[model samples]
Target: MKKTIIISLLSAAMMTSCFTTGDPRDGGIFWSPSKADARIGQLNQTNNEAMHQKQKAENRNKRLKAEKVRELNTY
Candidate 1:
């Protein structure tokens, strides 16, 4: 019985060690530094893309508002 308990504890520890703690994108305990760095780079790229899209939207809105103002001034 004692041996079975020890085996169970060891198995649980090994399984938990493989589990990632923070972001799901993060590599768990077994992953190398380069893999984690790559994940971080991907996240940064995604964020930059989102910011670019936001800026485009804002510029479009500003252009539309300027057109509306110009139309009103003509009338």
Candidate 2:
């Protein structure tokens, strides 16, 4: 009797879960941007932009320094 009752309860639970899956909202997790996700994305964009700008400035400075040295050596 205990086994039969336990089996029936489990079957009923499984059936409910299966039926609920038919609903669109409950079927799967949509990858909508939450506030945290948006904030994280924004932070990532800002950091990447900053790094790019820093690298460009460093390259420009290096080129300028090299040109100055070349001019001095040629004089």
Candidate 3:
């Protein structure tokens, strides 16, 4: 009986130690902040890159339009 009680206590401790606390999708409670922050940073970087590309395209279009106007004036 004593041995059984000791084994039970040890098993319970092991189970609780490995138990998750929060939502699994959010990376639970232990590593939530690091994982969430990394995901957010990745999304922000992707958005910034997309915005940079769009700005470059717009600038190119404007420059092309100005060149076309100059050509027309010369003609």
Structural similarity to truth (TM-score) of each candidate: 0.60, 0.55, 0.56
* Model 2 lDDT tens row, 1-75: 999999999988776654322224445333334644666788799999999999999999999999999999999
Per-residue lDDT over 1-75 for candidate 1, one digit per residue giving the tens place of the 0 to 100 score: 999999999998888778543344555655456666777888899999999999999999999999999999999
In TM-score terms, candidate 1 sits at 0.60
Please report the candidate that would top TM-score against the real structure. 1
Model 3, 1-75: lDDT tens digits are 999999999988886776343345644435555666677788899999999999999999999999999999998
Maximum-lDDT candidate: 1
Global lDDT of model 1: 0.81
| Stronger candidate by TM-score (1 vs 2) | 1
Model 1 error, position 2 (Å):
17
Tell me how far the alpha carbon of residue 46 in candidate 3 is from the true structure, in angstroms, after superposition: 0.8
Q: State each model's CA lDDT, in order.
A: 0.81, 0.74, 0.79
Superior candidate under lDDT, 2 versus 3: 3
What ranges in model 2 sit over 4 Å off?
A: 1-33
